[model samples]
Target: MPKKVVYLVVLVFFLLFHPPVFADITVVINELLPTPSSGNDWVELYNPSQNDIDVSGWILDDEGTSSDMLKIPDNTIIVKQSFKLFYVSNRLNKDGDTIYLNNGTSELDKYQYISSETDVSFGRYSDGSISWNTCSPTPESANSNCEVIVDPTPTPTPDPSPSSSASQSTSTKSPTPTPKATSTTTKSPSPTSAKLSPQVLSAASESSLILASSTSASTSPIPSMEATQSALSKTKVAGLLVGSGLALIGLSIGFYFWYHRVLGNPKKEQSENKT
Candidate 1:
């Protein structure tokens, strides 16, 4: 292969996989301590990109003529999203000054500020932001918190919970009893028995029927299981009502005797007076 074509092929391969030469120029003068209270004054460089940066010939300087600029060492590689620190001790003006970064040619970034407090460092918010703030010196690490531009993000509306499919149990309905095809003859009203009125006799007949139904219900071979239980319940209710009625009558008779015993009987007193 030709020499130029071979060289071109190698360059293209490295570029495709992100070699250091073609990395985007994203390095910024991140942090700097102008007024150092304890240690020497320092400046920090940061590369906030995924690809490594070859900041070999980059320059760091304050407001001075040609002789005062500091040149980065050759093959000085700053890995992605990392920091580099240089001790420009006593170089920065403690009162106030501007710091500049250059790629041996055009300027990369610069920061100008008024006088800084003692031991405080000024830098972009996180690393490469335009906004600057001051905090305790954080050399070769992140700057103190004032570089980022945060817009308020609205809280996402929570999705409505899906309605639960509640399983509603249908109530077991008591089935209506079907009538037989055979004719149902009404009993002819019979003469009153033992001075009982016809209405009372009719009621007595209905009571007898209810009792018979309840008694046979347990042993009766009914088709539906529910119908048998319903008949049994009806029988129990009728028995309870009859028992309550008898108890009420007994109580009424006992109360009549009690009243006569407690207070003197008016009829007996009248007869004694005549005597």
Candidate 2:
């Protein structure tokens, strides 16, 4: 009957149009390698999905600056539940540098680090689309308990003036009352000059130099403690969301099947008893 045909058509349409509950690829930044005083940085990518994903032709770039491009090899295939590490050739990006992952056409993920320090971002890629979240830079994401902390620079002390000792000594000398009687006599070179300590001057100069160096390092841009903490929070939330979504979807499917099995079997039994 036409009604049967219409029912079939509706079923077909529903099957075709329904959104899939499972994702194709899940990419996570598993690790950010140690940054040396100079040289390149590496980003580790993990494929958590069951199917293999070919990252060939994929590009990794640093934010708006496209000059630094990492190309995934044509033969590159991220096996199911495996990891791949991509090394970024660019050295320390000044401040506020962003690293982006793309597949020639669309951006897959983006991470921004406060300039001069090592920070990172991560995301997932599916069918040319990117699912991404920003994270505060971490020493490494795989190990959440461990973090990188930049030590505060020591404060500098002011250098003592050479004239201070001479002034102190002059102040201590008693004043002669007869001005004309002592005028013709040769004045003794102050004993204070010979008493001036070489060790004291050397120590003062060294302390002043150390302070100056510390001041310069302190002024250099380093991520604040609060900013680092914020970045970690963001990353943790993102990881939980990505890792939990599939598990939730699986649970939903299992519940749906159980519900149908329970109701359908009970209804069939009642129909047979009526017969």
Candidate 3:
């Protein structure tokens, strides 16, 4: 009976003095949707701790002095390290606003914005991180990295002109070839024997006939002077031939006598003795 009372007192002290577990819950306002297309605006909450947290009786509001707030229903559980979305009855502002999340007793988290882009949300770049960025709307999920990609435009190339092509052809052309010098050779004449005419006989002829003709009439004698001249020329030619022949005969007789004188003539001596 004594041990039971002491155990009861220890239980009461632990129950009363220990701080409430719900107050230490870690829940953050991760993403916000200020402008909606056709429904009430909403805010997403995330519990980053390892265990599930009870967010019942939690309050979400914008501009602390206004009536734009949402009280969570009882028995609401935000799963550990997960996302939970809550609709806020068109409470957020498109251009600028401030938001708050509290456990009905103490403030848990707050966010402020100057402007929100259309069709997008304002949230932490990495979930549970203090750095904020404008990102695509991700309800009840992890936030996305903020990035923009743009396509580059292509540039066109210009076509070549006729004048430019002609200029290039002219620049690459070869020079004209020079003509070579030609040489000429001269030929010498060969020695040839000349042909003699009838008037200038080449062979020897001692005697020939002489004829005389008179173009004009002459009355001196029966024979003309030209005829007389011709007869005399003929006679002189005949006499020269006769002289040449007699000289040859005389040379022969002289040679015969000279031979007899050198050698004895026995036959001529015998004939002289008989006479």
- Report the number of the highest-TM-score candidate: 1
lDDT of each: 0.79, 0.62, 0.79
Per-residue C-alpha lDDT of model 3 across residues 165-215, encoded as one tens digit per residue: 798888789566789864322243334332333354533221221112232
Output the better candidate (1/3) by TM-score: 1
Model 3 segments beyond 4 Å from truth? 1-25, 147-275
On residues 1-275, what C-alpha lDDT tens digit does candidate 1 reach at each position? 69999999988997777556545468888888888877778889998988788888788889855565578899888889999998886788877788888887788788887687887778888577777777667888877655333445899999976454422222235466899775323345544455576699899999999999888886856479888899999999999999999999999999999998767677788899999
**RMSD (CA, angstroms), candidate 3:** 42.6
Q: What is the Å distance of residue 53 in model 1 from its true position?
A: 0.9
**232 in model 2: Cα distance from truth in Å?**
89
Q: What tens digits encode model 2's per-residue C-alpha lDDT throughout 1-275?
A: 99999999998998676532233236555544334344566666766676677777877676565465677778777776777877676543555556666667767666665544444433233211233333343332233333343446899999987697789788788676775654222364546555546698899899999999999988969899999999999999999998899889999999999999998998999999999
Clashes of 1: 1
**Lowest lDDT 10-mer window, candidate 2?**
121-130
Give candidates' CA RMSD values in order. 30.9, 42.4, 42.6
